[model samples]
Target: MDKIRRWVQEGGTLITLKNASEWAIKQGIVKEKLLIPANGGWADTTATRAASTAPASEGKKTKETASASTPGSRRTDFVNQEHEGTRAIAGSIYRTDVDLTNPIAFGLTDRRLYVFRNGTTFLRPSRNPYATVAQYTATPLVSGYVSKANLKQISNSAAIVVSKVGAGRVVLFADDPNFRHYWHGTARLFTNALLLGPLLNLPEGPATISAEEE
Candidate 1:
């Protein structure tokens, strides 16, 4: 975020797309002409059944830190105090290690894939696009291409609550068949908005334009 903030302040543009539209525009990924289509509504699978589960990419476990014993009830603030000062000043502190014996996998043997988080397995058909968000929420089915866990949320073709993404702001965009176009624009807009805060110095400047094109 800090680095991204600096870039946006200096006049940087973030680009994103769905359906791999931009991916299609480039070579290698799509061997042929790839024209992204308009988005179709979510698909429904009420009668479908849940299929499988997959573990989120594991975070590596660090050596246990013995908690400090207290008089009444022992309380530890290890996770809080450990990375206090340098967390922001330093670069990203990404770690992935699951001290577990086996990582879980959740998915179905279908064309689409759904991803989820908060760590739990699903028992529904998650994919196959629907015509409306109403029909999409009628039942749970695991079916779309999910990444970063929480597969069903974004992958859901039906009624999806996108409130939790990017500071809990609900952004409504018209659908384009490729859907990727919206996400790409959304993701870029978000990155632009956030990084621009410090970069554009909105708190201290005259006026700064956000990702809003108009």
Candidate 2:
């Protein structure tokens, strides 16, 4: 970890895909946050069944019941296993807004890009507005299957983030830019990270130094 940190500090461009980006956030290598669902909304059949079958008490509501009954709390219906599995993106295409002015998006003729996603991972745009090179559109799903819940969460989320670590830079991609070697649309993003990452420069401020230098 220390070696990788030093390398990046000295001027290495680290490009991470999918889980690698999560790992980088966990290791404190980057100052970015993952886009997690409100309550981790995983299906809990056993708990749901237990709560449903439990006898109603005269007083003192159970914690789960109270939470469910609380005002403004989100209520989610229990879905079957097969139906709930759609939360994980099997394979989908989403529309992203690319910053044409940024060097990381250079050579991309279009301001809009269609990217391939096959996982549930999502990234929050950096606090530094300029660091986000690309972001998902308000209604990002272009094609393929994605759960309605996921679609709500993915709306207007960061697709690509670039942060400078000392003289080096780190690029985080929420999904694989090159999937199965057939997604030519987003392949340019991968190439841009390799060729132009070192040249990325953000506004001169403390936000740019939020990664490791702080």
Candidate 3:
């Protein structure tokens, strides 16, 4: 992880997915948490599930911190939120917003992009200038069997998160675009990240942007 941090400080881009997203966010690279169902069927632990539905607290605190333990001596701060998960939501078609202007979003056409199994995390307010390159607009349903009650509690979250860590770029995905070598709609996104990720613009300033995962 330290080596990875060094690469990023040297202007390298780290593209992470699924459980990897959980790791990066926890390390402060992405500023969010990748959540998964505590059990195979349920979305998350009871506490996280409930907190996921509660409205964003107006009084939530935002703080900043600086650390030079790493290579570039990056300083960052952002509000973090506890998030829940939907049953993987595989095989279901969902539309997410795409920022065409962002280089990381290059090659994607149409105002929206169709994807399968967007199990990524969401962001809360933060000082990091991260951007939501793509986000879910509607409640997501489990691919085969999910309760309406569960879906109703789902929050429209970022399907794709882009930010600069030190001199490098990081792209966080809810789930792997290449889940099983069958889902192809979002493969371009992964490709774009590999090709254009390093060139991704750094956040101009602090902006609103997730949680600890087991």
Candidate 4:
């Protein structure tokens, strides 16, 4: 780990995708946060099913009794576990807004690109606005199926983020850019990370830069 950190500090570019990006964040190799779903990851099917199958009359009585007996007991809901499972973004296409001005986006003519997304690994945009080279649009789902809950969570999330680590760089992608060799649009972005990684620059100072200054 120390060697890897040193290499990055000494002008080595480290590119990570999907689960690798998540691992990097966990290892403190990059300063970023994962965008957790509101329900806290996947649904608990067993718990939900148990709650859903209880007698309605008994549930009502229990709730009333609990409310009267315990002043601050949390209320539980009977949710459709099947519906909750739909929140997983199995495989889909989403539109991302690219910062054409950024070197990572060089050779990209369009400001908008469609990318394949197959998992729920969402990334919060960097505090440094300049570091976020690409971000999902307010209405990112371009095609394919995604639950409303998942779509809401993915909206405005970071699709590609690049940060300067000492003299080197670290690029993180929320989804596989080179997925199945069919997503040519995003494949270019992946290539850019390898070819133009050294060109990525951040303002010298705090990690975050306000949009107003730009």
Candidate 5:
């Protein structure tokens, strides 16, 4: 913790696991750890794969190399980003009841995903590519090449709604059923995902879930 404290004090805001490891040396978190780049180890793999259950065009396959690296990005022990944005890292009540039924489901591998973001009040970043605030939750679904599986079914077809939200071209896939469940605490873990629907929704397919946008 001390090494981490020094890194934070030294203007190290954004970081990855490797970066954290390096910072540990200065702050004594790890006692002389070296700074090494994280290959594809931290990038979100679930976001780009077709998986066995959900397949799609929009959710195309973006191949990930175990050692490949991208620019302006870092690897965290958390979501394991491919780049700067949250492609699909998730949080939730438990591991099994994850939120994969939603497109964000892939991150948890068809499980109950959750969000570690701020909450309903704040807005998204100024130059945000997505429509939601920086606080919403998600699990990476799919990306890359010719994928047509996006037209497939989510976990619970009837219990949720996958469509665009707001006018800014954001496609938010939300659920109305969890409103009561999240509050109950004992309610299903995924119930929070449904309750969070209205708040964390993002843009769905304007372009083909298969075609790449320039």
Candidate 6:
């Protein structure tokens, strides 16, 4: 982890997704942790079952009690990221809300994208200043069946975050844009990241320290 951190600090670009992003945060390569919190939404069975069958007395349980203690009952939060496991939101179509003016959004005439077996990811970056070039128009549904009604959108969450790390750059993708061979529409977005990430002159943030500084 330390070696990787040094590499990133020395102007090496890092493009990470899902578990890799989560691991980077934990290792201090990135400062913020992103997690899909345990809730009734998506494929969280514990949250669903608890909400459906638990009595009023169980509702009054302490935070410690509600805390993730079992495999099925574990919270999907970043702290329990490895616990709840990744979900595949099969056959879901997402609209990409893009900053068309941004260079990273080049060649994108349409905002629609498709996903197959897409995982559930909720990102909240607290330690770095990043520009959101694109985001899902709606909260991503993480199950075999995609349903718009299952999502509860929050204004601050994003699907992509681009930031400068030292002299290089880092791009964090909450979910896989290219899910399978059939979801070829999102390949352009991924290509944009590859071509534009290093070119991005991101605003200064805690993670933007110069390579010569330390």
Q: Give a tens-digit lDDT track for model 1, residues 62-87.
A: 11111223222565577866644432
C-alpha TM-score for every candidate: 0.16, 0.75, 0.63, 0.74, 0.18, 0.61
- Could you give candidate 5's per-residue lDDT for residues 1-214 as a string of tens digits? 5454554344333222212222322333221112122353221122211242344533344223222445546546654545323332132221113334443332333333332211111111112223221112222223222112211111111112222313211222222213434433223323433344444445432432212111
Off by over 4 Å in 1: 1-3, 16-151, 156-214
- Over the full model, what C-alpha lDDT does candidate 1 score relative to the true structure? 0.24
Model 2, span 119-211: residue lDDT tens: 877787787878889999999999998888889878888899997788888899999988899998788889988998768867744454334
* Overall local distance difference test of candidate 2: 0.79
How many pairs collide in each candidate, listed in order? 47, 0, 9, 0, 31, 0
Candidate 6 vs. true structure, TM-score: 0.61
Write model 3 residue lDDT over 10-79, tens digit each, in one string: 8888888866765676665554444344433333222433343445662132111213233235534433
lDDT of 4 by residue, 14-53 (tens): 9999988877776667766676533345321223234445
Please report the candidate that would top TM-score against the real structure.
Answer: 2
The parts of candidate 5 lying over 4 Å away from their true place are 1-158, 167-186, 189-195, 206-214
Model 2, backbone clash pairs (residues 3+ apart or across chains), number: 0
Sorted by TM-score, highest first, which candidate order results? 2, 4, 3, 6, 5, 1
Report lDDT (CA) for all predictions.
0.24, 0.79, 0.60, 0.79, 0.27, 0.57
Error in Å for residue 113 of model 6? 4.9
RMSD of each predicted structure = 22.4, 10.3, 13.6, 10.9, 20.9, 11.6
Prediction 3 TM-score vs. true: 0.63
Q: Say which prediction, candidate 1 or candidate 4, comes out ahead on TM-score.
A: 4
Task: Name the candidate, 3 or 6, with the larger TM-score value.
Answer: 3
List the candidate 4 regions with Cα displacement exceeding 4 Å: 38-85, 204-214
